[model samples]
Structures are given as structure tokens and as C-alpha cells.
Target chain A: MEIVVCIKQVPDVPTVRMDRERMTIIREGVESVINPLDYIALEAALELRQKAGGHVCIITMGPVQSEVALREALAVGADQAILLTDPDFAGADTLATSHVLARAIQKIEPFPDLILCGMQTTDSDTGHVGPQIAEELGLPQVCGVNEIHREGKFLVVKRLSDGFVDTVKVTLPTLLTVTKGLCPVRDLPLGALEAAFSTKDVLEWNMTDLDLKKEEVGFAGSATQVRRLRTPPPRGSGDIIEGPPDVLVGHLLRRLEALSILDEEDEKK
Target chain B: MRLEPTMKQAVIRRSVRKFSERRLIAAAVEMDKTEQFPWDIAEEMAGLQYFGLEIPATYGGAGLDSVSTAIVIEEISKANAAMGLCISVHNGVAASPVYLFGNAEQHRRFLNPLAQGKKIGTFCLTEPNAGSDASALETNAIRDGGDYILNGNKVFVTNGGISGINLIFAKTRADGKDLGFSVFIVESEREGLEKGPIEDLMGMRGNPVCPLSLRDCRIPLENRLGDEGGGLKIALSTLGGGRLGIAAQALGIAQASLDASIKYAKERRQFGKAICDFGAIQDLLAEVGTRIEASRLLTHRACDLREKGKKYTMESAMAKVYASEIAVEATRVGVQIHGGYGYTKAYPIERFYRDAKVCEIYEGTSEIQRVVIARELLKG
Candidate 1:
């Protein structure tokens, strides 16, 4: 059995900056850190591999610098790091990124049995790639996975959403978007840290390794454009009308009536 | 030169404190009641190159500087403060005389073996009548045809009862002058030389600061450390370097007290709340933490100065005075924070308090340090 955990490198949240004039993020001088959410995903993948006796390979798609995030996974006990770095993959949105990542996953030497990712990236806050990639691979996708257990060849996983819990059995080749609530991760002990820093065998791959066309990566691959960017205006400040339930209800009714949004019978209750 | 402990030295220093190789202590609490200096522990320290601290590797010592010596003392002191002082007195105070003033042959014979820890050494400067006054020695070493007949009684001599070599200070013949002192490396096995049992003290009880008496004891002329009447100079310089070590010792004590205080304050709860959360307790905790850090920095800086071959006498004196006083204050507060539990020996704060007081008294008392500081200041 094999597992592929997707990870990313993002600037530390506190130090992140946006270039207002250029309509982009300010990367220079920002301290890049391994995405915290991705650590949960990596932890999930490692645990699954450990329990099932399988190999865990970390697959990531970004520029050349993305190799750093991949290396971090390797240091935290990942079996290998697969980096999909190419100029053609620049500016690729979630849909494009998922497609390229799926291609890279297929190109891995031993392939994979399952795919894992964070519920969302801290910077983007877009929860689209996990589902998109699962759709592209024709594998069943599980999001907000709080508990995953191995039962024979299939996996019993608990997915929680909208305050509802669903226990599902998914066959091999499944994807999960993990949340921080899923599990707490830890930094490896000091002795292991020295060994991790000394060990180097992370696999660095490019478009050519996946037999990808140059036009299908980087700037050429991205489809949709992010043109004008600005924050939505702030909501208005309103008075805090505190009172007994009857009084508050009466006041609310008058405000709603003034706005012409209340019906007469509804106010009696 | 920027001096730091080599990796091997750091490991060895820790090993001694960690009790890596052998059982240095027979039992944890026996040394105090029986003021018996463990020759085995001394041999182990010598084997590990701690006995001859600051003696270069070429001279058979671990070749550590004053700073490295302080670090070693700190680690050892964490486990046993008395043993820490024992090493400090032997290496830093007793050994400094020969290392600073001895000739090439003297270096080869006395320093090399002492540094190698093969032959334990002691410095005999304090007498029944003289404690800090270097020039007021009553011991005499008159020239008697190729030899100096030594006759003297020195008290409060550290490692006095146990050490193999004694750097004895005595007055040589002079024209009715203020004790023209000269230092000699006295062997314990020599006839008519005797050492008394350990002196009982309120704290640092384990170190056997006893007596070294030269009752008609004769020594070879070559045993003299440096030149004629240079004993005072050698003793002062050696003691000046030793002051930095006391500062480091005080630093360790203060750190332990501060750590114990924080741990106690956080755990011990008062009426409905943890004591640490209280405004008054919080202030004590913060002050203790900050002062401990500041003292550690100053102490280590003074140690670094000694290692760099730069003159740090005044700075070391200041650090010794400040850190020692801080130790007393810090440990007292640590006991106070314990709110009654800290007063007992069951916890370390009380010992830390008792230990803190000695740092002020020894290695040129806090008053002496101020004198040295003011003198240095006035000279400029």
C-alpha cells in the first residue's frame, strides 16, 4: 500500500503581506514556513502508512522553491518527496493545480493508494483542490476527516460537516481534506532532528518527468485571471438595544416594521 | 582569542556531573557529616582534566580557560555545590600560583602532573592571623644552604587534609620587613608536615577546609614558585582569577533558586488561586527571573575575559560581588515563595540560601571586592 500527502510552503501568517499596488502577495523578506494545516495532513498520511505497513510519499506542486516544503515532509518521516516544479505551472488556480498534481501523482515510481490534503490553505482559504483532484483521479473523496481506520483493504473514515457525522468505507485510492481538529501534530524529538537534517533523498521532479507539455504548466496553464482585488466594505455599526425579552421583542418588531420586513401574526409569538 | 569549551571538554564536564563512569559519591548525603574529601572523586576529576583547569593541554591539564572552568564548576555544582567548590579551590585558587609563577622545570614537575590530576595540589596562603592580607604571613622559609627550612601554620586551607601538593606561602629572611612571603610547592609526604581534619561549616560543609602546618618542615630551594618576594604578586593574581569562578558559582545557585521558585509558585495554590497569579508573587517571580539571567550574563562575560588573556580583575570582582549578593537575595526570595515549605532541607531552596551566603564570604569577600573595585577606579 502507498500514500501520497500533499503539502505546501506559505509565509508565516503574522509576517504575510499584500502588495496593494501590484495586486499580489509580498514574498520578499517574508519568512516561509511549512503550512500548519499541511502538517496535519502529513501526520495523517504517516500514521496510516505506519499502521498499514505502507510507504508514504509527499507530492507537492509549486515553483522550484516548493521543494523546501517537500523536504520538510521528508524530514518529518515521509518516505520520499515528489516536487512538481516548472515555470509552466505558474499562476495555476485550484482546478489547474489539481490536474497537474494528479498527473504528478500518477508519475510517482510506485504510484499511491490514497491522497491527503488540508481542508484549506491558510493564505488562499479555498477548499476546492481536494475535491477537484479526487474527481480527476476517479477516486472517492472524504473531507473534514476526523477519524480514519484501516479495515481490511478499505478504510473506515468519519467525516463531519454541518454538525452531521457520516461513517464511510472508501476503497483504495481515496482523498481526504484534513482539519486541525482532526489531530494534533508534534515536532520530532531532538535526536531524530539531527538525523533528519543529515538525511537527504527527497525526489525532485519537473514537467519532463511527468511527460507534461511546457504549455500546460506555469503561466501558460492557468486559465482564470484575478484582475481587481480589494476588501469588501465594513458592515455598519448599530445600537445595542438591551432589555427584557418582551421589551426587546417589541423593539425588534418596530425596527422590522419600520424596515417593512415583519408580518403582524409573526410578532404575536 | 574567542575561547569556548571544546566538544570533548563539554562532554567530559557533563559526564563528571552526570556520574557517567563511576560512583563519585558513596552516598548522596554522607559528605557533609563526614567532611572527608573523596580522593577517588578528586582522581576522577583529575582523570577528566578538571584538577588543573587553565593549565594548557601541553602541560597535561585539560587546558581549559577560566570560563570553561566556570562552566564545569556550574554543571558539577548543580549536583553538589561542595564538590564544585572543591574543584574550584584546587584548580583555580591553589593551582593558579604555580601556573602563573613557576619556572619551566617547576611547570614540568608540579603543573603538568597537577594539571593531569595525577598529583592533587593545594594553595596555602591563609594563616590563623591572616585571611585576606597577603603580606602579613608569620610562616618563615629561611635559606639553609641549598634548602629553605619552612616553619608555619596555615588555617582555612582548602583541600588541606587531602591534597598531595601544597603551594605553601611563607616569609623568607628579610631586614625586619612586613613578612617577605614566598610560595613553595610542599609535598604532603614530607617529614614533619601534617594536615588536620575538615573544618565544620554551616554551608559548603563537604569541602575540607582544614590546616596545613610546616613544623620544622624543610623544602628544596627549587620548590619556590617564582622569584624572591613574588609570593604576594602570584597569590593576588591567582585570587583575582578565582573571583570569576565564585561569580559563576553564585550564578548557578541563583539559577537553581530562581527555577525552584518558579516551579513552586506555579504549583502551590493559595486561597482559591495559584500564588503565581497573585500580583505580589508575580512581581517576585519576574524580578528573580530577570536578575538570574542578568547575573549569568555578567558572570560568563567575566569568565570569557579570563579565557581571552585579557585583564578582568575589576570586572570579575564586580561580578563576584553582584552575583553573590544576588544569590543571597534570590535564594531568600525563593524560600519566601515556598511559603514555609522552602525553609526545610527537604527542598533545595534552603540549601541554596545557605550556599548563597558563602559566595559572598569566600574568594575575596564582597567587601574586599568593593575595595579592589574602588582601588582600581581611584587609580585612574
Candidate 2:
């Protein structure tokens, strides 16, 4: 069994500014960290591999600095790391990023039996890369997965849906986008970290290595482009209405009726 | 001539900061209130290899440099000074001597498990009679055929009760004429060893500081560290590095005080304006920030010297004195900035105030550090 985990590195600050003209984050002095939710996905993959006896591989697409994230994954027990970096891969949207990742997965020996990803990235927050990768790879995909376990050749996953959870069984060679509820990430051991930083085996690949055309990757292959970026306006402070319990309920109901949030006739019906 | 940390050091700082914020910060206040040793957190930190941050990889350590070790201590101390004290003692004074002076066999037997965090280690040089005048220790070890019969009482030992390995210093006589000191690696599970109850201290309450009593404790002669009469040299050398660890801890505490003060000053209102707008408060903040930065530079300079195998005795002493003093002053200002809230347990500044005092007293007192610096200067 071979498991693959997709991760990304993002600015570590709570709020980031974007360059509207370039449609990119102004990352001059901001520190980068592994996308926190991806740690949960990587933890899930590691746990699965630990039980089922398989190797865990981590893949990320970004600039050279993304290797820091890969080395961190290696420190936490990932067996292999592939860094997909190229000038052609720059400015790629989720669709092109997923395409390149799918191609890289195919290039791995003894192709992955399971692919795991964080449900969403903190930077992009689109939650589109995982499903898109699954579509590109033609594999069954499970998103918002909070729990996963291997049952022989199939995967039993618990997915969080609106108001309820759905337990689904998918056959082997499936993709899962895990939520933070999947599992808590363990601390990286010091010895493993020392080895990871010193080793030179982290494989770096480019578009040429993946056998992809320039037009089929990066910005040229992206289907959507960001036109503008701006911070949302600050929310107004709330008003507090003080009255007797019955009067307060009545006032709230009257306000809701005034705003057309509640249909009085429908309520009567 | 860059004073800032290198990229690798920055990475270490970031990683340690994340670890401390996630694991230590929440428990720090509660641990201080309850005065409980954080055994679970210690186990977790060991898994992270914080217990062996500077020891080599061959001994199950992080194989990091002295600067990296200092960075780890500083980050951890910023969150919880008590845990920081435990780590500083374990890595700096206790385990380092073995790695530095012990033979390969001793390293395999003692340093490996201690560095791996499989067993906690501590230094036992201070006794009832000896505090700063370490050579005046009353503990004695008598050679008795293939073993040494040891009898001693150690006080204020960090990680005392929980430690599995203890590096103890005792007076010995290879020849009847001369009174000399020797160091021994004594296992806690041995017979005739008694662990006293943990001390109720003013600060750094989470550290399990306790007294240890040994009566006729039998340690194999093979457990001796370095040659006979070389114990003082070993102790002094180990403490040179240990002083840097304490300096880092002090720097961390000082930084924490400044950080807390800044946040509180900005949020607190007085005279219909934020207190931070006042010139008095700004002066205090500016002074604290400058002193903390200066302390950090001194500590880092000592760490750099140690990394390059240069003699850092004077440098470490200077760093320890200045940084610990800065910690006390910064935390005091932190409390003053919080006004009445600082006196109460409602704020963390009170705890920082308590914790900062010990940095001046332990490792070496401010006066002792001054003496060391003076001695170094006069020698030239």
C-alpha cells in the first residue's frame, strides 16, 4: 500500500495583504508555514500507513521554499517527498495545480493506493484542489472527511455534511480531503528532524520532469483569474435591546417580520 | 556582522515557538497555581527531542548547535519558565558533562538514554553547606573495592525526584594528603537513596525542586566521570555552558514580560486614552525593549563563542548577569504597567514577576557573575 499526502505552505500571519495588480500575496517578509489543516491530513495518512504497512509520500507544488514544508513532513514520518517547482508552474490556479499534482502522482513508483489532502488551504480557502485532483486522476473522492480507516481493499470514511455526518465506503485508490477533525498532529521528533534537514534525497521535479506542455500548465492552463483583491469592510457593532423576556421576544419577532426574514402568512399557514 | 539569527536558527525558533504555544502556554498558569510537575508535558517534550537539543545525533539528540539549543530554551521559557528551568538543568549541567568528558562506554550507558529522554537527568553539586562556594561541599565518597560508598545531601535539585540519572559531586581522596573532588553518575534506583518532598518555592513552581539524601550509596567505579581530582574542572566547564542556558531563559522571561506589558498597555484605558500613549509608560516600554535586545545579543554572543570552541566563561557570566537582571526589571515594570490587576492572580504578570526573581538567584547569583567578570577582566 502506498499513500500520498498533498500539502501547501502559506503565510504564517493571521492576516495577509494581496497585491491586487498581481493577484498574489505580498509575501516580502512574512514567514511561511505548512498549511495547518494539511497537518491533519498528513497525520491521517501516517496513521493509515502505520496500521496497513505502507509507505507515506508527501507532494507539494510551490517555489523552492516549499521544501521546508516537505522536510517538515519528512520529519513527521513521511517516507518520500516530491517538490514540483518550475517557472511554468508559477501563478497556477487550483485547476492547473491539481493537473500537475495528478501527473506527479502517476510518475511515482507503485502508484498510490490512497491520496489524502486537507479539505481547504488557509491561503486559498477555495477547497477545490482536492476534488479537482480526484477528477483529474479519475478516482472516487471524499471531501470534508473527519475520519478514515482501511477495511482490506476499501476505505471507510466519515464525512461531515450539513447538520449530519455521512459514512461512506469507497474502494481502494481513492482521494480524501480531510478536515481538522481527522486527527491531531503529533510533534516532530528531534532526531528525525535533524536527519530530514541534512538529507539531500527530497526529489525536485519540474514541468519537463512531469512531461507536460507549457500551455497545459501554470497560468496558461488556469481556467479562472483573480481580477481584484480587497479586505472586507468591518462589521458594525450590534445593538442590544433590553426589555422583559416576553417584550424582547415580541420586539425580535417584529424586527424579523419588518426585514421580511419571517413570512407571517407562511407561519400562519 | 549580522546579529540576527541565521535561517536555520529562525526555523528552530519558529518550531519551538509553535510547540510551546500549543503545549506549554495553556498549562503554565495552572501549573504555577497547583505547583504540580508536568510529567505528561515532559514526555511530550522528550518526544520532540527538546530534552536533548544540543547533544549529538549519535546519542539520540537533535544534533543542533549551542545557538539552536539556546533558541529552543528561549522559546520554551517564553511560555513556561518552570519547564524551561527543568530543561536547562537537564541538558546543560547534567547530560552535557557526560557527553563532553565521559568515555565511549559511559556515553553509551548514561548519555544515550538521558539524551533520548528515556530518563530524566539532573546535576547535584549544591548541598546544604554549599551554595555558591561549591568546593565547600560536605558530601564525601570513599573508595571501597570496585565501588564507591557515597554519603551526601543535595538541596534545591531541579528535576530531583523525577530524574533517573544524577550527576553528583563529592569530596574524595585518592591519596590521604590531598582533599579532592570527584564526579559520579548515580542512578536513582540504587539503594540508600532518598528523595525528599518537592520544595514549595516563590517562583518556577512547576519545577520539582527537592532534596536528595544518599547514605552509603554504592556506585560502580566505572561510573566516575573524568579522572580523580578533575571534578572541579568538569563542574566549572559544564557550568560555563549552563550559565548560557540560564541567560537564554532569562532573555525569554524578559521578552515575555515586555510582550505582556505592551499588550496590556495598549488595551488598558486611563484618562480616556490608552495607557500606552502616556510618556511614562512609553519610556518604560522603550527601556525594557532595549534591555531585552541587549541581553539577547550578549547571550547570543556567548552561544556563538561556545559553538566555535572558544572560551566563553567570562562571556557566559556577563550574559547571565545582565539578562537575569533585565528579566527582574522587565517583569517588575510589567507588573507596574498592569497596576492593581498585576498584584492579583488575575494577570500573568504577577507570575512572571515571581519567576524572574529566581533567574538572578540560581545558576549563579548576580554577584557571583559580577565576580567572574571582574576576575576575567583583572587577569588581562
Candidate 3:
């Protein structure tokens, strides 16, 4: 059995400086870090690989800079790392990024039985990429998975969803989205970090490695677009109406009636 | 790779201040209530790794940085102050001089085992008349056939009662002034050595605080920390770094006080609501949080500057003063928040409040920190 883990490199928000003059992300001299949620994915993957006889391979898609994230994975315990990096992959949205990763995983020869990814990226916060990848690969997927218990050929999981706990069972070939409910990744010992330095180098793959037509990958296949991103226009400043309990209640009712929010027989009815 | 410390450094700092692995300081706070001297705590601190913070790997130490050493002292002090002071002074005065000044043979004989946490050491600087005034110390180490016979009494010597090694500073000068001051490392088995009975104190009572005297005590020639007249400089540098660790201890005490206050406010009720719900209590809580943060930032900033290999004497002195004063004020406010319960021994606030005062007196007094800052600024 083999496992594939997807991770992303994101800017360390605390260290990332803003360029007020140009109004742009000042990447120069700023540090990039592995997305925190990726820790859970890596932890889960390593645990599974250790219990079952298998290798956990890490895959990340970005520019040359993304190697930092891959090296972090190796230092933590991933057996091998692959960097799906190229200039042409720039400006790819979650949908396009997922398709590229799906194609790349499919090309891993002895394909992995399971793929694990973080539930969300700190920078994007979109949370759409993992599900899109599962759909693209036609694999059964589980999200918000906190734990995975092995039962012969299948895997049973404890998952969290909308104020309820769901136990889902899935076959060998599947994908999972992990959240904080999962165990935190262990910090690597100094000896392990030194060993990682000697053993792991990013295996860079270009567009040709995925064996995908230009029209079917990168920004070309993506279906979503962000017309423009801006701060939500300031909600006209909030006002507090203060008085005794009865007077405050009367004032709140008048305001709600003005907005037709307290109308009788409405949604509450 | 980014410029920031690697994740290992960001997470697991080096182990500088530690106790011996062979000995563990049993954590029994109640036994210390009768002013019991924590000889076991000192031995346990040596066992845990605080005795030889920077004495290199070859010397059998973990060889961690100053920041990590400072953190260890801080954590230990949070549980007990006497234990923390014992640790800081041993490393600062006893082990530090030998590591910094002793020759290869001296280091091999003394520094090696001490760094490895096998033994304890003491710093003998203060005299009956001199406390902060190191230059005025009158201890005499007169030469006698390849050995120096030491005479004079040292007061308020930290770890004086339990240490196996004593790094004593005394005047070798013909005149009775600060000049010709020399440091000697004397073994505990030396003849003519006297340890005064433990002095009574309101705080840090769990550790022994006593006077150490040298009456015709002789030390080998090779035991001197440096040539005559270098002792004062050595003392200043060691204590300069020592102040940083003391500041960190103060920060921890303050944080623990604020933490206790926050916990009590959330649970205790007043005026029919959890006191924490009251705006006045909320304001008090906010002030406690704010001061704790400020204390930590100042303490760490001085420590970080020291780690960068910069001159931080003034910064360290300022941190020591601010953190010490803040610990007292914060613990006082903590007691106030607990109301009548705060003043009682039922809670640890009363103990914390008592422990916070001595930080201002030791190392260099808050008044001395002012002097150092003023001198530094004036010289600039």
C-alpha cells in the first residue's frame, strides 16, 4: 500500500510585510511555511504508513519556492517528495490546481490506495481543492475526518459535520480531508532534521510529467474566476441603543419593525 | 531557507539551564513552609541541567544558549523562587568563572564534572560591609608558598551552604581598596572555611541564605579566576548575564500571578455575577494581561539581544528592574482580586506576593540598574 499527501506552501502571515506604496504582496525577504492544516494530513499519512506496510509520498504544486514545503514534509517523515512546479501553472485556481494534482497522482505508476490533504489552506481559505481533486479522480471522499481505524480491507472513520458526529466506512482506494480534530504532527528531532538534509531533494516535474494536454490543465480547464477581490464595504457603522431593560426592548422592537424583521408569521412561524 | 530560526529552534530551544539526571529536586512545596533549606532542590537543579549552561559539549553539558538557560530558570522559579536563585547564582558565580578563566588543567579538574551536573558550586563576592559595592570588598588572599591563604568574611553568598565548589573573590592588593582583586576557586573540603547559619528572610525561604567566611584558607595558585585586578570585570560580566535570567524568573512569577487572577475572576462571584462579568473586574483583568505581556516582551527582548552577540548590559538591567517591580505589583493586585482569600495561605498568591520583593534586592538592586542605564546613556 502507498499513500499520497498533498501540501501547500503559504506565506508566514506574521512575517509577511505589506508594501503600502505598491499595494502588493511583498514576497522578497518574506518567509514561506507549510500550511498548518497540512500537519494533520502528514500526521495521518505517517500513522497509516507505519501501521500498514507502505510508503508515504508527498506531492506539492507551486514554483521553485515550493521546495521549502516539500523539504519540511521529508524532515517530518515522508519517504519521498515530488515538486509539480512550472511557470505555466501560475494563476491556477483551486479547480485547476486539483485537476493537475489528480493527473500527477494517477501517473505515480503503482498508484496510491489513499490520498490525504488538509481541509483548507491559510492563504486561500477556499477549502474547495480537496473535494474537487476527489471528484476529478472519481474516488470516494471523506471530509472533516478526525481519525481512521483499520478494519481488514476497509477503513472506518470518525468524522465531524454540522453539529453531528458521523462514522463513515470506505474501501481501500479513497481520499480524506483532515481538520484539527486529528492529532497534531510531531516535531522532528534534531537528528531527524540532519538526516533529512542529506536524504531529500525536491523531485521537480514539469508540465510534460503529468502527460496532460495544454487545453485540459493549468488555468485553461479551471471553471471559476474571481472578478475582483476587495475588503467588504464597511457595514455602515453600528450604533448601540442604551436604556433600561424595558426601554431598550421597546427601542429594539421599533428598529426591527422598521426593517420588517419582526413581522408576525415570518420565517419563525 | 528563511532567515527565521528553524522549526527546531522555534519549538525546542537548547537545554542550557538544567538539573542533574542522577538527582531530582522533589517537588514538595509544603515541606518548605517551615523555611526548610532545599538542599535537594539545589542538587536536583544540578541534576536537571542548570548548573553548567554554556560549558560546551566536551565539558559534559548540554551546551545550550542563554535564552534557553533563562527559560529553564524561569520555569523552575514559577514553582519555587529559592530554587531558581540557587540555580542562577551557582552558574553565574561558581561554574562561570572556572569555565571562563581557568586553564586547561583547571577546567578538566573543576569545570568538567560541574558542567556535567555531578557537583554544585558557589560564588563568594559580597562581604560583611559590601553588598552591591564589589570594589569595596575586603577579603584577602595573601600568597603563601605557591598557595594563597584567604581571610575575610563574605555575606549573602548564594548557595553558600550546599555547594561543593566556591569561587571566592578577594583583594590581593597592598592597599585596602578595590584594586588587585583576585578570584579563587576553593573546594568545600578546604580547612579554615566557615559557613554561617542560614539567615531568616520573608521570601525565598525554601533555600538557604548564609554567610561564608575564609579564615587562613589556602587555595592552589592555579585556582585564580584571572590575574590580579581582573576579578571585578569578571564579576560584572557574569552578573550582567545573570540579570537576564533573573528578569525571566520575575516575568514567570508575574505571569503566574496574572494567570491565577484570571482563573479566580472567572470562578468567584460578587454582586450576583461572576466577578469576571463586572466591567471593573474586566478592566483589572485587562491590566493584568497587558502587564504580563509587556513584562515577557521586555524580558525576551533583552535575552534575544544577548543571543545575537550584542552588548545588552543596559537592556538586561532594565528588564531586571521592570520585571521585578512588575512581579510585585502584579502579585499584589492578584491578592487584591482574591479579596480576603488573597491574603491567606490557602492560595499561592500570598506566597507569590512575598517572593516578588527580593528580585529587586539581589544581583544589582533596582537602584544599580538605574546607575548602569544612566552611565551607559551618559557615556554615549
Task: State every prediction's TM-score relative to the real structure.
Answer: 0.57, 0.92, 0.61
Candidate 3 TM-score, C-alpha based: 0.61
> Model 1, residue B175: displacement in angstroms?
8.3
lDDT of each: 0.75, 0.90, 0.76
Q: Give the per-residue lDDT digits (tens) of candidate 1, residues A157-226.
A: 8988789999999988788888876776743321222233345555777778778876666556666667
Clashing pairs in 1: A88-A217, A88-A218, A89-A217, A89-A218, A90-A218
Q: Of the candidates shown, which would achieve the greatest DockQ relative to the real structure? A: 2
Give the best candidate by TM-score. 2
lDDT, candidate 3, A1-269, per-residue tens? 69999999877775345455544346676566778888789988998888997999999999887876787688778998999987777768888899889988998868889999999987778888889889989999998788898888899988888888899999978999888868865534333443354455768888887776666666776676665545557788799788899999788878888998876765365
DockQ: the better of candidates 2 and 3? 2
Model 3, residue A116: what's the lDDT?
Answer: 92
Model 2 C-alpha lDDT per residue in residues A189-238, reported as the tens digit of each score: 66676677876368999988999999988999999999877788999998
Task: For candidate 3, give the lDDT of residue A65.
Answer: 71
lDDT of 2 by residue, B112-186 (tens): 998988889989989988999997998988888888889989999988968999999999854354558999999
Candidate 2: Cα lDDT at B314: 98
User: Between prediction 1 and prediction 3, which has the larger DockQ?
Assistant: 3
True contacts kept of each: 0.00, 0.54, 0.00
Worst 10 residues of 3 chain A by lDDT: A187-196
DockQ of 2: 0.48
For residues B75-127, write the lDDT of model 3, one tens digit per residue: 65766667777767766666777888888998998998777556677778878
